[model samples]
Every structure is written in structure tokens, then in C-alpha cells.
Target: MSEQATTPQDLADDAVVLDVREQDEWDAGHAPGAVHIPLAEVPARIDELPDAEPLPVICRSGGRSGRAVQWLSAQGYDVVNVEGGMKAWEQGGKSVVSTGDKAPEVL
Candidate 1:
């Protein structure tokens, strides 16, 4: 939403980062502080989404997140797909964190 290079810390006060990757992918690595809601769970987990604007959505790559953005947009949420997703972030030198004891890595 703000910029394609968005990290958790880079988001504005009213903005939030959503990682729509699966459990395994998320456990592999993700942006620290990002709200995770796997793409498949988005509909049932609608209430879990933060009431924030400019929701920055991401996945392993741009495909899933792009679909999420399209669906969320139709539902009246302000969302944008993070182009290239986590791969772009990792390549861009943005920080990543793991859900387990292992080091962070894009999966």
C-alpha cells in the first residue's frame, strides 16, 4: 500500500501487513509482526483481519496475494498486493522472522 518494499516496521500507523502464506511456509519465515491468515482461511477468518487501512498483502510470490487483494477489494477493504511477495522482501534486504527455532528463510 505505501510502497512495495514494505516491512512490518515500514507500515504506517494505520496500515498493516498480512502474510497469506500457508502454515509451513509461514513457519519457514515471514516478516516479523505480520498478521498471518492463509489465503484459504481468509473468508472464514474475515473477523480476524485488523480494522486497519492500506492492508499490505503478501504470499510466497505475487499470485496468491494478488488474488487475496482482489477479493478483499471487492469486500470493501483497502488492500494491495506486495509485488513479488516475500521473495522480493528478502531480496530487498528486509528483515524476516521464523515461527520456530530455525532461522528465517523464504519457502
Candidate 2:
């Protein structure tokens, strides 16, 4: 299956942002409104994702998310790999949500 790539801007418009990082990484910081499902758990947690549109997968440096895109796309789910991941999101002047007791918006 062919997989698409998405930019942070595209993600902001209309897409479900999936953070494939581990719990610790997610707790440290993550994109605001992003869904946290570590790569290790995605196979079992696939049902948690919506079935309507493509979802963008993100990781710290794009590695894990790329793998996720590959895996999910193979499973027939519309998935996009967010190039450059969270680092790019921050570099692109996008917003992130810190995962503390409650996720807080970070400028």
C-alpha cells in the first residue's frame, strides 16, 4: 500500500496525530492533542485509532514513526509519517503538549 507523508501544518488542519514514543518520552513532552500509543503497543492498540481518515505518526526523530507508518499502511489503514517528527514540529514553530498529571499546552 502507498503511504502518504504529512507536515505539521497538514496535521494541524485535519489529522489524528499519533505519538509512537514510549511512555517516558510522552510524559516528558508531546504534540498538543496527539494520541499516545507507543510503537510497541500499536499492534494491539490498532483498534484505538479511527477508521475514517489517515493518521499521522510521530516519534522523537522520525525513526519509529516511519516504522509505524509502514506497519499501519500494510494493515490497510491510511497512515502518514510526519517527517522529522517532534523535533521538526518544534523547529517549525508548532505547539506541543506536556504530559504531566494533565496534558498542558506548551508554546
Candidate 3:
């Protein structure tokens, strides 16, 4: 991983994570308070990203988030790709939440 990538273990306690996974993936499971904006929607959702803080971007694995970080960085956003994304998050024993009443699991 580059300096722009961070493992779930390195995530900050209070930082808000920006989830760039698709809607179905998001509906299955995600970190509580994570912002849901699919990779395809980022161009239109740039206004929603954190402006003053370093945003942590995640996806199913690291692939999509890595792409997002590259684009977001080019636009001057201080962003970091979550190295292992949500899969690592769940495996690291971090909390996960789901839409509706479903149990949260990384799909």
C-alpha cells in the first residue's frame, strides 16, 4: 500500500469513512456513519465529501476506493484509500450496520 492507503487498523476513531461501494453492497453492511456514495456517483457527489479533513474512502476491497482516491486527490481533496476496505473492517472486528433490520455483514 502507498502512503495514500491505510488498513482498517489505522483508521481514526472519529473520522468519517466514505463508502464508495454499490447500493447492494451498502445495503448488506457498512460502518456506522459511513457515507454511501457509489464509485459511479462520485463525480456528482464531490460536494458531499469532507472538505477540511482527510477522508477515508472504502469499497468491497481496495480496488474501487483506490480509483476514487486518485480522482479525488487530483481534485485537491485530501483523501486516503482504505487499504483493505470493508472486508478488512469486518474482519478486524469493527462495527458494521445494515439497511432495514438485516444483520450487518460485508457482502
Candidate 4:
């Protein structure tokens, strides 16, 4: 069955947002308080993922995060994919940040 997907605005204040994009993509910009774990590394680092409610996974777009959600859910995670991903999050004016003063943006 397809899992539920939610927009940035719909996420709860305490939700855990997981970014499954590549390292460079994550370095560019990501949602504030989001966790960065590349899709390729998820299997090996699955234990690092938060055991929390409304675990929304995201990427540049929804594709990669969607796949990650599928795998994580199968592994017994209470996860969901962020519909439209970071692009939508940025477009929706949600908070995003990078390591430095550079303006945050999706790569």
C-alpha cells in the first residue's frame, strides 16, 4: 500500500524530517532541524534514524525520499515521504539553512 505523504505545512511541530539526498545536495540547503542521511547510506545507518512519529523523509524532489520511505517502513519505521520534497518546502517558505552565510537553496 502507498504510504501517506504530507506537505511541509502539514507536518507537526515535532516531526522528524529526514533528507535522503546526496551529501552535496544536503550541503546546499535543507529544512531547518532536518536530518541528513543520503539514500545510499540509509541501510547502513538505519539505527541513526529517529524513532519518532510523523517521520517525514524528503529529497530534492519526492522520488528518492519516496523510495527511502518505502524501505524504512518495511524495516518497521513509522515514516512517510514529504510530498513534493524540499522544493515544495522551500517554495512554501519553510525554514532552510546551509553551513555558512550563503543563501539557502535546493541544489
Candidate 5:
């Protein structure tokens, strides 16, 4: 299958952002408005994922999210991998939120 990747800037304002990182990683930081669904729980929680084109999946660096994009694509969910993942998102100065009062930082 062909690869589909997008940068933080390319995403639509109302895009469905799926963060596939672990629980702790998500607590540390994540794109504002993005959904928190860790990679391991994806299969079981597949129904929760939006049935939209170009669903954006992100991880700490991109490996896990890339794998998810592949699987999701095969399942007919037009998914895309967030290149460079949260690291790139942060470097791009994109807005991120955290559960804690402290400023969100990619972990």
C-alpha cells in the first residue's frame, strides 16, 4: 500500500487527530483537540475512530503511528502518519495541551 503522511501544518482545523502514543506520553503532551487512543488499544477501540478520510495518527516519534496508518489503511480508513510525530509538532510550534497545569511538552 502507498504511504500517506502529513505535517502538523497540513492538517485541517477540524481534522480528526488520533494520538497513538502510550498513556503516560499522552498525559505529558498532545495536540489540542486530538483524540487519545494509545496504539495497543486501537484494535479494541477501533469503533471509536472516526470514519473519515486522512485520519491523522501521531506517536512519540512516528514509528507506532506509522504502523497504525498502515493497518488502518488496509482496513479502509484513509489514515495518514504524522511525520516526525509529536516531536515535529512541537518543533513546528503547534499548540499542545496537557492534563497538568504545567505547559505541555513532548515526552
Candidate 6:
């Protein structure tokens, strides 16, 4: 099934929000309950994602997530690029979880 792109608010109750940012960035702050799988590792880690439905991909900015969407879509996975990424989520007033530590290294 084709999965259309969605906003944080449009995410289904059971949908998984995949954060493609590196570990440190994730630890510093991220969408609550987001799953971290660095961009470079996504191809190998694809199995870690849920297969029941499409997943929403997110990044610090929209760029990485959009790239991920392209790759995943080409791979036949049901995925959506979250436009504007975390920036959009923050602007939408969504809650972010912070680890109170140093920021993560951007890969």
C-alpha cells in the first residue's frame, strides 16, 4: 500500500515515528517516543521498523528525512517523509524529550 506523507499531528495512533538522527542528537532532544536509527544505518536496520503499517520518518531538518523517504519508498516500504522534520514538530507544539547532556554529533 502507498503511504502518503504526514504531519506529526496526522500520525496515526499506532504509527511509528522514526527519527533518523544520530544517537547524540536523539539524546539531547527529540519527539517523545521516537525511535532512533541513524541515517547511514537505516538500510541495514530496516528490519527494526514495524511492518504492520507505514512509518513517518523525521530528522533535525527536513532534508535527511526526505532522503530517507526516497530510499525507503524505492525499497518498497510504506514510509512517509515528515516535512520540516523536528523543526516542524517543535513548531507544532509537540513535546520533546531531553537528556540534559551534550548535543549529539551530526553525521
Q: Each model's TM-score, in the order given?
A: 0.85, 0.83, 0.93, 0.90, 0.90, 0.80
- What pairs collide in candidate 6? 24-104, 25-104
lDDT of 6: 0.76
Which is superior by TM-score, 1 or 4? Answer: 4
Candidate 1, pairs of clashing residues: none
Model 2 deviation from native, Cα RMSD in Å: 3.5
lDDT of 5 by residue, 1-107 (tens): 23599887787544679999988889988888689888889989999996567788989888999999989888888888989888988888788788888778899
lDDT tens digits, residue span 1-107, model 2: 13478777666733458889988788777877688899999999988875546778889878899999989989998888888888888777787667667653322
Backbone clashes (count) for model 6: 2
Query: Candidate 2: where is the Cα deviation over 4 Å?
Result: 1-3, 13-15, 101-107
Give the whole-model CA lDDT for all candidates, comma-separated: 0.80, 0.78, 0.87, 0.83, 0.85, 0.76
Model 6 lDDT per residue over 1-107, tens place: 23557777776433468999887778777876678899999999988975545778889877888899899989998888877778777777677776666542322
Please list the residue runs of candidate 5 whose C-alpha ends up more than 4 Å from where it truly belongs after superposition: 1-3, 12-14
On a 0 to 100 scale, what is the lDDT of residue 36 in model 1? 94
- Write candidate 1's Cα lDDT for 1-107 as tens digits: 43433443355433457889999999999887589999999999989996657778989878898889889989998887777788887887777888879989999
lDDT over C-alpha atoms for residue 48 of model 2: 89
Q: What is the lDDT of residue 21 in candidate 5?
A: 93
lDDT of 6 at 42: 93
Please list all clashing residue pairs in model 3, or write none if there are none. Answer: none
Native-referenced Cα lDDT, model 5: 0.85
